[model samples]
Target: MDEVEKNKTVEKDMKKLVNKSWFRYWLSAEMSNSYERLQSLSFCYSIIPVLKKLYPNKEEFGEAVKRHLNFFNTEPTWGSPILGIAIAMEEEKAKTKQIPGEAITSLKTGLMGPLAGIGDTIDWGTLKTIIYGIAVTFASSGNILGAFIPLVFTCLTFIIGRYLTNFGYTVGKDSVKSILQQGWIKELIFGTSILGLFMMGALTSNFVKIITPLSFEIAKGQTLVIQEILDSIVPGLLPLCAVFGIYYFLKKGKVNYGVLAIGIVAICLVASFVGVL
Candidate 1:
């Protein structure tokens, strides 16, 4: 009787161990690795079916699920690192006791705010306006090769993310001191962000377009038009002035984007009414 009970207990523990998705362990390692990284190749939902095998019961798997289910929360550019760190932590914890999945909900609530701030100001805030600017300039001039710029940028995101994923995983098993000593995360993230800033500056120079409007005033002798006077000031100055005006309103008035969009429509209508579209 005693032997049978012991065997049953062993089987239960073994089954519990088998029930977890071991791969997610890598995610936990990666998220802790750097402020920015990417690792996911497919939607996290796709992994759920396979993940079922890793947990024998719902309660035992909650923490892992909560942490690993970051598909919608993360951008492709940062997926790998986020998933890797989540997975890595879960696996480490599994060695002793199972973590309740709901714990992830609380953890995420805390981490997401900081991550979002870092991601936006560094990645999208500065990078998007810059790189896309270059892309448009190249594309607009009918330069067929210029279309490749954004595509290349997209591919570059994947490459950077994959590299970070690998780096994080390799270091996951190590102590924090050892990992920090390598300066791998700092070097990669800082170096990349700096490069991103540089790219933004270069792109800004290429992409911004301004067109000015000129008016003509017909002289009493019908020899002069307003376009003659406007041309004397500067070509395209009107358009540049309009842009600055709108920017000032947006900043000073604290107008929301929606309000600004509505204002644009209203201005367009007024311009069309006056034959100034």
Candidate 2:
């Protein structure tokens, strides 16, 4: 190989070499114990789709898949789709003679909106509402189902993601390009995302309830239970509304998360002090 080809070969080899370290870091499974690992791309699940191209053998693929699966204990909401994008990047790299700066830049830029849209839709909206509904159901029955909440979702993530990897890897480069280029597919992704958001909202509206005590002074002596008060707030609606309102304000004014968080804390504290929580 020419010197240029030699450098290219070396770069590919270095990427491969780094995968070993990345796999080891992921296998550590020390979430919340060492966030540095997560921050260091150890928690990056997006590397999976690309790995099939980089490593073709079943042994390498299986090992990489297992390592990726075992490596992170945190929620894989964004991680899964991020892995999808990584696969797309690798496919793009393989298709081009040289990595077009514009291509890479476009992918990066395009991912931002999709990532935010998907992350907020699935993680904050669909998954949380579903799991919360499940947990609250079990917990209300005094079964401590809330404790198993994270485990249940983790299993779910693995199951869904296994398919995503299978499909993305099997289809490889051309498929990814087609998925990206097709307007209908993009619409489908957004449409499903919207449906997920709506379903989550509807579920949360019906299932996620908060209770508190209240009294009707003008009428004959009446004790209004917390759930009843929630009915007045549009039938189990206020908490979600409150959160969305806060989120809206934060978005509208460009408020920092810290400030919003502090506002939330203050609201909680005040509510607690007043026995309204």
Candidate 3:
């Protein structure tokens, strides 16, 4: 085929690979999760259509499927972009027949960590907190606004997810070098982490309620309330302390979650029975 015809054929193939139906497949990217490879099976499943188009021979198609089915796991939301880029790279490999399976696998593995970090920081740490914060405020007021707000947020995220998938394919292999070399990914992670911490503090203060009812006679008639004294020193002092205590235990990693939960329940029950809380 002539150069122009080859270019036209590549464009047609790429257009076919990244269509509306393909985006639907990418959206179901986490449906086949497993403990062994996590999203590896679904990841392979998402790109099967592309693989079929690129690798005509049964042996080549099988090899391509196996190559993608190795080990793959990342945040499903932002990870769609990585999937798009991988599809483009696989297309190139099929055309040139030079890129080895190891190279492709290595690329996927290397990108997973960084992409997951970015995705978790943005999606879980920042965006989720913002959405939940707003929704909870409305729900606390006994309004349906909270439910509708989260539904809107979910729709917006779906659209953004689709866009990221297409963007990844559009950027192709440069997606890795561009993200790492430019250093913006690091800045994004740092910014989102700081925001997440601030949100966590706000949630703790608003939700965690702790107070003491103990009272002592200071002199002949004067009485001192322990909770009032603690509040005077710092509002939510007990709550802050409780949070830090739990954080300390969690950081230690020696205590199981179930044991910690039971311990907290036991402590609360004892304290209430003794009238200390």
> Compared with the true structure, what per-residue lDDT tens digits does model 3 show for residues 147-238?
78877666766777678877888887464345445754445345545554565586589888989999999899999999999999999999
How many residue pairs of model 3 clash at the backbone? 0
Per-residue lDDT of model 1, residues 22-66, tens digit only: 233323333433211232223244235434544557875664454
Residue 211's lDDT within candidate 3 is 94
Q: What are the C-alpha RMSDs, in order, of all predicted structures? A: 14.8, 12.5, 11.4
For all candidates in order, the CA lDDT equals: 0.48, 0.52, 0.76
TM-scores of the models, in the given order? 0.40, 0.46, 0.57
Residues 3-42 of candidate 2: C-alpha lDDT, one tens digit per residue: 9999798556634533433343334323423421332244
Error of 3 at 247 (Å): 34
- Regarding lDDT, does 2 or 3 come out ahead? 3
Instruction: Give the worst 10-residue stretch by lDDT in candidate 3.
Output: 183-192
Rank all candidate structures by their lDDT, best first, as comma-separated numbers. 3, 2, 1
